[model samples]
Target: MLSRTADHLYWMSRYTERAENTARMLNVSYETSMLPQSASAATKAWQSVLSISELLPAYYQRHDEVTLEGVLHFMVRDETNSSSIYSCLQAARENARAVRGALTTEAWETQNLTWLDMNRLFKAKKFETDPAKFFEWVKYRSHLSRGVALGTMLQDDAFRFLRLGTFIERADNTARLLDVRFHAIKNDYHGTVPGKGQAQFDFYHWSAILRSVSAFEVYRKVYRNVITPERVAEMLILRRDMPRSLHASMYEVVQILEAVANDHSAETQRQAGLLLAELQYGRIDELLATGLHAYLVHFLERVHALGGRIGSDFLATADM
Candidate 1:
C-alpha cells in the first residue's frame, strides 16, 4: 500500500471517531449549558469546552456572537470549522471513499448514509425548532456507525489502524472532557454546594457524560448512586474498564501502536513504551493531589505531542 493510502485509512478512522465523540460531547455540554446559568455562564462554559478542544480561536474568528446560537452555528453548521460535526463527517466520508476497496461495504455505507443524514438535518429547520432531536439523531448515527464497523470489518492491519485511530481519539476527547468537568466543578462547587456544582451537579450533565459512551447504565451498575461531579469526572477519566475512559482508551492505543510498529527501531519503541508506562502507572490519588484539571491539561498536551511524534516516525515518512 502507498504511504498515502495508509495515511487515509488512519485518518478515516480518526475523523469518524472525532465526529462521533464531538457530537456526544456537544450534546452533553448543550444540556449542561441549558441548565440555569447566568447571562454569561453558558458562553463561558462553551468557551471553555471549545478552548479545550482547540477550536475556540477558529470559532471566534468566524462568529461574532458568543451566544448559544452563534457557537452552535459555527460548531454544528459551518463548513469551515475543521472540528465541527459537518467537517469531521465530511473528512471521514472522503477518506472512506478513497479506500473503499480496503473497507467493508457496511463501513462505507454506514459513513455515507450518516453523512447524508447530517447534511439533510443541517438543511432542515428541525435543528432550530427541536435541537434535542437533531443532536439525538447525530448521536444515534455515531453509535450505529461504530457498531457496523465493529461487527462487519476485518481484524487485520486496516482494522488495527482503525482501532488505533478510535482509541487515540477517545483518549484525547476524554482529556478534554475531564478538563472541562474539573474546571466546572472547582468553579461551581464553592458557590452553593460544597464539592458539588452550584446547581446539584446537574443530572443532565452526568447523563451527558454517561451518554457520550452510552455508559449511563453501566455507571449506574458500577457506582449505584446518583451521579456526583467528582465521581463522574473520576469515572470518565480514571476508570480502566470504561471504554471511553482516558486510561482504557490510552491503554488500547498504546497496545495497537506497539502491535502496528512491531518492527520499529529501539528509539521509537522506547518513546511509545515510556509514554504508555506513564499513563499506566498514574494514580488518580496522585492526580487529585496535584489537581485533576492541571494534570488533565498537561496530560492532553503530552498525548497530542505523542501523536505528532507517531506521525513523524511511523505514520508518515520523513525527508532523509
Candidate 2:
C-alpha cells in the first residue's frame, strides 16, 4: 500500500475510536457530577475529565470557569479543539474519503453518514437539551462504523492498520481514565478512615468508573467482591480477558503488528511486545508498591512513544 493510503486508514480508525472514548469520558463525568457531593468535589470531578482528556490548557484559554455548560461545549462541539468529538468525526470522515477505494462500501458510507448526522445535530443544538442522548449517538455511530469494517472489509494490510489504530487509541484512553480517577480518589481520602459519607462517595465513584468502561457487570462476574481501587485497577489494566484492558489492547496491537511486519521496522514490534509482556506478567501489588500514578504515567509515555514509532516506520510519507 502507498504510505499515504496507510496513513489515512490508520488515522481514520484512530479518530473514530477517539470520538467514542471522548463520549465515554463525558458521560462518566456527567453522571458522577449528578451524585451528592460538595461543590468543590463536583468541580474536581469535572476538572478531572478535562485533565484526563488532556484538554485543560486549551479549555482554560477559552473559558473563565469550569462550568458544565462550558466544558460540554468545549468537548462536544468545539471545532477548534482538535480532540473534540466534532473534530474527530470530521477528521475520520475526511480520512475515510481520501481512501474510499481501500474501504468497503459499507465502511465508507457509515463514516460519511455519521459525519453528516453529527453536523445536522450540532446545528440543531440537540445536545444543549439532551447531552446524554447526544453522547450515546456518537458511541453508536462509532460502533456501527467498526462493525461495517469488520463484517465487510477484507482481512489484509489495510484491515491490520485499522485495528492497530483502534487498539492504540483504546489503550491510551483506558490508561488515562484509570490514572486520573485513581489519583483523584486517593487525594480525597488522604489516609483517613472510611467515614460513612466517604465510604458512600467511594462506592459511587468506583461504580461510575466501571460503568464508564462498560465493565460494571464484568467486575461483578469476575471478582464477586466489593469494588476497591486496587481491584478496579487490576481489572482495567492487567486482565487480558477484559476487552478494554490495557493488556488486551497491547496484545491486539502486537498481534496486528506481527501480521503487517513485512514492511515495518522491528522497533515498533519490540515496543509493543515489551509492553504486553509487562502487562501479562507484572503483578498489581508491585504496581501499587511503585505508586500506581507513577506507573501509569510511565506506561502512558511508553504507549505514546510506540505510537510515534509506528507512524514513522509505517505511515510517514514525503507528501504527508
Candidate 2, residues 1-320: lDDT per residue as tens digits?
A: 77788899999999999999999889888877787667877888889999998889899999988988889899999999999999999999999999999999999999999999998998898888789999999999988998999999999999989998999999999999999989988887545535786677778889999998889999999999888988999999999999999999999999998888855568889888999999999999999998999989999999988888888888854122
Find the candidate with the highest TM-score and give its number.
2
- Candidate 1 backbone collisions, by pair: none
Candidate 1 TM-score versus the reference: 0.88
Predicted candidate 1 versus true structure: per-residue lDDT over 198-301, tens digit per residue: 34656665576677667899889999998876677677676778878877887787677777774543455565566567657776667788878787888787
Stretches > 4 Å off in candidate 2: 189-194, 317-320
| C-alpha local distance difference test of each model | 0.74, 0.90
**Candidate 1 clash figure, as a count:** 0
Q: Against the true structure, what is each candidate's TM-score?
A: 0.88, 0.96
lDDT of 1: 0.74
Model 1, 11: alpha-carbon shift in Å? 0.9
